[model samples]
Target: MKLVSLNIGKPAELSYKKKTVLSGIKKRPVQTSLYLSNIGFIGDGQADLIHHGGEDKAVCVYALEHYAYWEETFNRPLPPAAFGENVTAAGVLETDVHVGDVFQLGESIVQISQPRQPCFKLAALHHEPKLALLVEETGYTGFYFRVLTEGKVKITSELKRTEIHPAKITISKANTIMNNKNADREDVHMLSQLEELAESWKKPLRIRLQ
Candidate 1:
């Protein structure tokens, strides 16, 4: 595996409709960078950045990975993503990754914290009526990060697989939580905490449940 691109974007206003209610929301993609600090969350075990409802965050996201790597969608270089990811890696299969998997990028060590879970913001990015349905059909999106060590990383940085586990949660489970309409604020908090468990395991989980 290798890093292909480092991406980031700023927040912008977008419109959404639910029933008879139409609303505009402000959201930003974290600034992507080659270095750790500029990337958002940078720590020894894992790094994190907030993902907007319709955008990607700092660490990892699937984007077009599920769709056979599109060069352009909506006339943009990147497919819809919540926040810009710091590293775009080739040969990093989302489903294949497990908790203990170790990815070596430049001088950095990254572990797969969990599968990426998407939100309503995906509809904003695509402007599609059934964006959520499309995502359910294709599971090649979203990724998580646990930084083992800090170091410089650049576009096209080589991603070496140092370790991986065989048994782990499926990507589908992660999305189930992320996409649940009935999920309350407490549920979201629980999902966030699961990232810690993903750090030490040989294979991180796809979803966090009590």
Candidate 2:
């Protein structure tokens, strides 16, 4: 899998309904290579620390193929980073890769940590309050990566799987279980017990089991 685009941006005021809130969702595509650190790209920023920009979610990746779906719905061509992702990737979809899978990307090493769960930022961006719901219903929610080796990366960076998780819990399965309140208890427990799963993702499932 390779990045079709690389984008980054800082938090800025955004209009949502009648209120203005600071959001880092609007990212601009960049052509130059950027330094990838443990936290994220050097110039990238996340407005909400409580929910974003941690080591386990340093990079947000969305499938380039998803763009076609959105473009068709909107009846317009959308630019890269339209989904606020740091990397617009091609080749691997949520069903193609599993959580904890390690990959050599560009000059850095990274691992899939969790499927991306979003707030209302995306809905607000399009002035469509239910857009986030549509994204979930479509199973187009993206995924995040935790940097293992800090280095440089760019739009041309390709992901070469170096290791695969034995548990084989794909991002599609994670999102399915996560959004399903009636999900099997054993499935929940199994996902929570994964050693490579992010603590943030584990905690919710752990609570549900209780």
Candidate 3:
């Protein structure tokens, strides 16, 4: 897959729902190469660390194809980094990428950890109250990456798959299991046991399986 854009943003206060809140969701594409550390992009910031940034979610990747889908569905234009993804990529979708898949991007190596769970911030950012719900329903919520080899990366870099884990629980499947209230317990248990699945995802599944 090709890395179409590299986006970065810092925390900024914004008026949402008549209240001010700090958010780093409005990222813009960067023209120059940047460092990719274990935590995340060198200049990127996450306002809510509890559900956002960490070793398990260092990079957020969104499929460029989804922008077209959203634009057509919403009847409006959407930018590359509109989803607050660190990498806008082409040729790979959530269904095609498994949770344990590893990829080499420029000089850094990253692994797919889990599907992104849309929150209210998305609706507030786009001014569409149902946007987050639409994303979740469509299962187009992109995915997260955990940095395995820290190095430099650029917008022009290509994403090359280096390894595919044996479990093969795709991000699409994981999203379905998490969002479906009646999801089969056996399936959730199987996915939760994947070593590559993020703790944030497993914790909830474990609770559900109880």
Candidate 4:
């Protein structure tokens, strides 16, 4: 799919909260962006600055098809995103991705390091109170990456799948299945499937789920 637009936010607020003691609370949504300043490779935490990969961590340039979308369902403004994403994407599915997959953003190439798991900081911002729990239910929340190659990327740049290892799982299936299953069970079987697929790939595949 073509990259419709590129969006970057700087120094946006992040927070967390819980509505009722028993209910699954919404992750407080706020504006945030991926920083070119602090990024890390696999196993790096977003909070730690020293360990980050510098601009090498391409947290800022995201595919719009997957992470960011226009909410026609709401005349109201979309709630702020709890976890700040560097790239607001459209068609790129997160779970389907794996290490070694190369996402071509114009001339720049980015490698998938790991999934962007949710943190408490997101919930406190919007006052949703239980955001982390809600995100647990919705895997579409987005992720992080390290820039294998760096260059200027802007809105309307096409996102091409250049390389993907066979050992990777498409996050799209997992995310969709999670939405279908009842929320009561704490099932993460999708994660197992992802890991399984990740092991099967010899080389990375460059295909986005249409």
Q: List all candidate RMSDs to the true structure.
A: 8.1, 0.9, 0.9, 9.6
**Backbone clash numbers for all candidates listed:** 20, 0, 0, 44
Give TM per candidate: 0.60, 0.97, 0.98, 0.56
Which structure is stronger by TM-score: 1 or 4? 1
What are the per-residue Cα lDDT tens digits for candidate 3 across 93-176? Answer: 988889999999899999999899998888988888998999999999999999999999987777899898888888899999
Candidate 1 global TM-score: 0.60
Q: Candidate 1, which segments miss by more than 4 Å at Cα?
A: 18-33, 38-58, 63-65, 69-84, 166-210
Model 4 regions lying over 4 Å from their true place? 12-57, 60-76, 79-83, 172-210
Comparison by lDDT, 1 against 4, better one: 1
lDDT of each: 0.49, 0.91, 0.91, 0.45
User: What tens-digit string does per-residue lDDT give for candidate 1 at 36-128?
Assistant: 542333321111223322111225634335444433443445443333344455566656565446677666776666665445555655566
Alpha carbon deviation, residue 165, candidate 1 (Å) = 2.6
Better of 1 and 2 by lDDT: 2
* Residue 47 C-alpha lDDT in model 2: 91
- Kindly state the number of residue pairs that clash in model 3: 0
**What value of lDDT does candidate 1 attain over all alpha carbons?**
0.49
